[model samples]
Target: MSNSDPVLLIETVRPDDGRTESFWVALVITGVLLLGGLGILLRQEQTSATDTRPQLDLLQRQFLMELTIAADEIRFITTMNSEVSTDTGFVNWPLEQLLQEQLLPVFPGQSAKAWQQLEPGCLLLPQPASRIHFGLVLQQAGSSIHYAPADVPLPDHCETLLSWQRMDIQS
Candidate 1:
């Protein structure tokens, strides 16, 4: 080479192939282990859910029975919640008792200053749920439930109950 002439160096690269088989074997083993673990996790979750179903069914039944008893024995209408008219005297046993303890913890959202007639409806027991300022009247017979008017002038064939509806408030 003459003075200042460029000199080049070249390298030949080779890929390693002997260990390729071991790498693929390790990958396959890891995939199988991961899949097995995933399957076990899913099965455990399904078993837990199955166990909870029976508990949920029992809770539902107990809740229903308590509601029925509550509806059968409830009082109605105080001076703060209702007027002292004959209609007020007639109202008792609201259907809302069915969902009192189940729904609102503070069932009676009223003041204790409200007046209550010493007299109760047919089933004379302390009101189970909270006091409703205004609620719809209802009647129950065995399993049959029905809406009642402000003044129920019918025979005592069915059990009286009370419930409430939200008043439409215009914004």
Candidate 2:
């Protein structure tokens, strides 16, 4: 054939030649492996996402427990005021130890501090005639004991208590 003229030689096609079939098989195997890896990754991510909610829930429960204990401690302090001196009273008791041992262990990284200046009773009462004040005080004390900015007055004490309950549910 001339250099410019195309050769038209007849060649027999054979199915027994291994190279072409092997290449196709390798490509299909590689594709399947990649898809399997992707599926595994997605499943692991889903599992991790599901795990986070329980952790948050455990945190909320621990916080609520801490608040309840602290409220009881406050009540104890108030009750014991006549017998124990203020400096040597229940307020001065090692609350941090109780928190660390009983509550912090549940939450892992939670930290707590009790202040002498703030009393659960103060936040509980607005005036002598406010009959609902005592219940509000108990609720608020339980709510604020675990959260920060304790001085911020709750608009509705009952609502604040409900909010904590909701947080517990969501978590």
Candidate 3:
């Protein structure tokens, strides 16, 4: 009976099919893809931000020119009106539509809007949703014409092209 006693042991065995290596490779690939996507997203954001500057410059130039034209026209009209006693019908028309026609081709996806329904003196700049409404400011500063952003606290001796009445009150 003692001789009949026997010991038995069981051991677990794993097959070497390179599964661990495969898992590591897959993890590395996923990480690289994620990083590449993140980098691309960041670059796109940078490019878009840079692109806005050129459009902004063009808008500013056009806005300033229009302001100069308006001021000269108004000053001339004022002189003419002083000489006459009756109201001239020329001063009542809104100027936004005419300006927009010339500027539409230069800047896409933006429409010129009046600063106020009753007044045709100013305009609010069109910008993307993430951006604020920057008012185009133009003024005659001595011999030189001054142009600046209306939202700026002190706009370097420039008068706003558009009135603040039409901008969102919360902004």
What digit string (tens of lDDT, one per residue) describes model 1 on residues 1-171?
A: 887998888988778766888899999999999999999888873444343222223533443344344333322223234422355344343324423433211123433223222233222112223212222222222221122233433223223333222221211
Candidate 2 ranges with C-alpha deviation above 4 Å: 1-17, 39-153, 165-171
Off by over 4 Å in 1: 1-18, 45-127, 130-171
| TM-score order of candidates, top first | 2, 3, 1
Q: For candidate 2, lDDT tens digit of each residue in 1-171?
A: 679998889998887879988999999999999999999888873444343322234544554565456556555544555323344222332434434544222233322332212232222212122111111132212323323222344334434533321222111
Candidate with maximal lDDT: 3
lDDT of 3 by residue, 61-144 (tens): 565455455545543553555422244222332445435434312134555442322233233343453243444322121112
What C-alpha lDDT do the candidate models reach, one value each? 0.35, 0.39, 0.42
Least accurate 10 contiguous residues by lDDT in model 3: 137-146
- Model 2, position 86, has a per-residue lDDT of 45
At residue 130, give the lDDT of candidate 1: 23
* Model 3, residue pairs in steric clash: 122-161, 122-162, 123-162
- Rank ordering of all candidates by lDDT, starting from the highest: 3, 2, 1
The C-alpha stretches of model 3 lying farther than 4 A from their native spots are 1-56, 83-113, 116-171
How many residue pairs clash in all the candidates, one count each?
A: 12, 1, 3
